[model samples]
Target: MGALLVVILALVVGGCVCVVWADRGGPRWTRVVAAATVGSGRVLRRYQKSQRREVGGGADGDGD
Candidate 1:
C-alpha cells in the first residue's frame, strides 16, 4: 500500500508538470495530459467542497 501511494503521488506530480509545460506550449502530447490534469483538479475541488459542507464548514471566505 505504501508503494502504491508513492506511485500515485509521483503520477500526480508528473501530471502537474505536464500541465505547466503544456500551458507554456511544451508539446502536443502535453496538452492531453494538461487537460486530464485540469479535469481531475476540478473534480477534486468539487469533492473537497462537498466534504467541507458535510462537515459544516462554511465557504473559505467567512473568517471573522
Candidate 2:
C-alpha cells in the first residue's frame, strides 16, 4: 500500500513537471501529459466547488 501511494505521488509530481516543461516548449509527449494534467486539475476544481456548495455553501444560512 505504501508503495502504491509512493507511485501515485511520483506520477502526480512528474505530471506537474511535464506541465511546466510543456508550457515552456518541451517534448511532444510532455505536451500531452500537460494537457491531461491541466484538464484533470480543472475537473478537480469543479468537483471541489460542487462539494463545497453541497456543504454549508451559503453566507446567509439559506441553502437548499
Best by lDDT: 1
Clash pairs of candidate 2?
A: none
lDDT score of residue 1 within candidate 2: 100
Evaluate model 2: give its lDDT: 0.88
> Residues 1-64, candidate 2, lDDT per residue (tens digit)?
9999999999899999999999999999999999999999999987877787778554535453
TM-score each candidate: 0.80, 0.81
Candidate 1: tens digits of C-alpha lDDT, residues 20-45: 99989999999998899899999998
Q: Give the TM-score of candidate 1.
A: 0.80
Task: State the TM-score for model 2.
Answer: 0.81
- lDDT, residue 24, candidate 1: 95
* Predictions in order: lDDT: 0.89, 0.88
Distance from true location, Cα of 60 in model 1, Å: 5.9
